[model samples]
Target: MNVLKDVATGVGLVLATPVHMLGRLVSNVWWPLKGVKDEIVLITGGGSGIGKGMALKFADLGATVVIWDVNKKGADAVVAEIREKHGQDRAHAYAIDITDREKVYALAKQVKREVGAVTILVNNAGIVTGKPFLEADDSKMVKTMEVNTIAHFWTTKAFLPDMLEKNHGHIVTVASSAGKVGVASLADYCASKFGAVGFDESIRFELRKMGKTGVHTTCVCPFFIDTGMFEGAKTKVPWLLPILKPELVVDRTIRAIRMNQATVAIPRFLYFGQFLQGILPPSISDAIVDLFGANDSMDDFIGRTKKD
Candidate 1:
């Protein structure tokens, strides 16, 4: 009986060898490595805050980066710094408004021609006007949607064909944690972000269905960030949901993009908030939200306009 048991174990090991080998082959083929050195990466709104942070990180990692921002001077400055640090050919800057579909398509073509095919696209351009729903003008609401939500579609449509052709690429959508929840004085902002989150998730699902698994999508949902974008905004839970630093956020986001993870939430606790919203009683959840001052915190919001 002991001899029979030993033989059975040996047979099991023999069968498992092929499975182990297959797993190793997949990892070797797909895992992040130095091969990304020559790949081109495009980051929208790359002149400041989270977008700039991501651009710098990618450039540091040896990928050729393009800074696409509406702020021509700011983008040029970032490009200068990158070129200074990484050599002149490592970085480039383009001043383009992503909301303009024609301009976005033109820029994508120009990037492909000049910088090589864009292997990574970061949709990070967004705007937030902290006006109550009733107080928001039609123009303000339209501009908010155009910049925050529609730009994603325009930019993605412009560059995704190249990714599909290559069958390898990453799309990173820098959405806010507010995308997952509704708050006061930010109805427009919340709607736009939520739309972005949905867009990223849907694209991911479609890619999986199409068997284009090599093309990865990551939706980053982080709480208030210390990017000076939300300068005077109050924090509901400073300890639990401390405003994330741009560097830290960019680091985690890069990790997620490298790993091809589906979604990334900063603080990790925000996942619990999502779960609680679904399970708790409406009144109890409402009371908790109110107690946390989630709605009222944006009342004093002083955005990047106040910054130099």
Candidate 2:
């Protein structure tokens, strides 16, 4: 009976796959986007880079925006810009270290009191130590894990309860292509991102199982962006794998949030590459990676000096 059930499930999936794909394609292209005008969006690392860009975009869309960063000045500048274009009450800035779980919880409560229950949470702040594993500083590695992976837990916990109560919210995880595939010279960074990607997926499944289908989760996995955070990073074949731009990533991310996309791989080619990497033998996969010169792309690393 169990074997029959397995065969039945397989047959059902085979029949459903094409229809699912076509429905997804059509919905992505033609579905009316969900509105965010009534939302209160909180974005970590909103001081600069993609975080700043997303803040401005969300404010432009008429959502109240909150910016959190260790760099208070940068967060304030972004808030000021949003106010100038939108309205005085359209944006707010808060400076806090997301790595501190207790502080994060405290600030979250303050945000709720000052602004409102956060309806959209964007976990975007991350740091990278572009050094070989043996050469990487122990402190920097711990910092990287705290910011990239562990902070997600703190931030999500701080905001997710409200989402569960209402069953109407969005969580955007700004991970990296490094989260999906390993690259040379980024051992610490890659491990942190892998954790982040896993975190997002697990939470998504948990939410669905709890029947909170309206609470959407999007895990954004983009290749290195031109955001100075990954300065000097390069690809041997630009046509096949060009470095992404912050603007492009921001736009796609917003769209994905509206459409409630589960996982968004920028350039779309990443999906194919990941599929191949999964099915191919280790030796062949390593050879392909070596041929593309991906592992050596960080040989001349000059990442941003300041955190976002």
Candidate 3:
């Protein structure tokens, strides 16, 4: 009876999968955003680039936005701008070294006391070293991992308690396309992003196992954006994998969050690319990457400054 019941359930879900997906698609189109507006959204690395762009959008939607960045001046400027445009209480900024776990915890406590429990945590802080594997220094590689991957671990540890307590919150991880597929000249970045994608998937499963269904997570993997971080990178196939724009990335990201999507690949083509990677032989995958110039996209890399 147990085996029969289990098989029946499996068959039911398999049969219903398309219907369920279609319903979800309709809901996404019809539903007004169910989050934000009175929620406190904390965005790490919110000084510039994608983080800053997301901060503005969150503030526009009436979420009290808290920005954490190593650059005090840039964070403060963004906070001031958001306040000026969206009213004084709509935004706040903190000079936080996200790489430091202790500081993350301490500031999280302060944020809870001051700004209220953060309901939306965006692990947006990231760094990249565009040097090839052998050419990249130890510090650069370490910093890349610390900022892009380890910071996700720390920030989630800090803010996730309140979220779990209420069983209502959202976590967003801004990873990269490198997380899905390997790339030359960005070995460290690829590793860190892959780690992030894995982490997000694991935690999401943990949440489900714990019956915390209300808490949602989204992992965003975008292609190269003109955000100064991947400054001189180029895509050989513009039609297939053109460099993403910051605004477009943020827009898609916000939509994903609003709809409670698990993971989203920018431009949507990467979904097929990931599918190809899964079944193709290693040699064929490598040949495809070489043909697409993804392996050499970072040949002329000039990444952002340390302070940025």
Instruction: State the weakest 10-residue window (summed lDDT) of model 3.
Output: 27-36
Return the clash pairs for model 2, or none.
none
Model 1 reaches what TM-score against the true structure? Answer: 0.87
Q: What TM-score would every model get versus the actual structure?
A: 0.87, 0.97, 0.94
Model 2 has an lDDT value of: 0.94
Clashes per model (N, Cα, C within 3 A): 0, 0, 0
* Candidate-wise lDDT, in order: 0.86, 0.94, 0.92
Tell me the lDDT of model 3 at 99: 94
Q: Which candidate is the best by lDDT?
A: 2
- For TM-score, candidate 2 versus 3, the one ahead is 2
Local error of candidate 3 at residue 117 (angstroms): 0.5
Better of 2 and 3 by lDDT: 2
lDDT of 1 by residue, 1-308 (tens): 99999999999999998897586457546766434577788999999988888888888889999999999887898899899999998999999988889998888888888878888899998888887899888787888888888899988888888899979888889998989989898899999999999999999989999999778899999988888778778877888878788888998888778777778889777877888999999899888889888988888887777444
Assess the local accuracy of residue 66 in candidate 1 as a C-alpha lDDT between 0 and 100. Answer: 93
Instruction: Please give, for residues 19-129, the per-residue lDDT of candidate 2 as tens digits.
Output: 987987897679788999989999999999999999999998999999999999999999999999988889999999999999999999999999999999999999999
* Model 2 segments more than 4 A misplaced: 306-308
Question: How much does candidate 3 score in TM-score?
Answer: 0.94
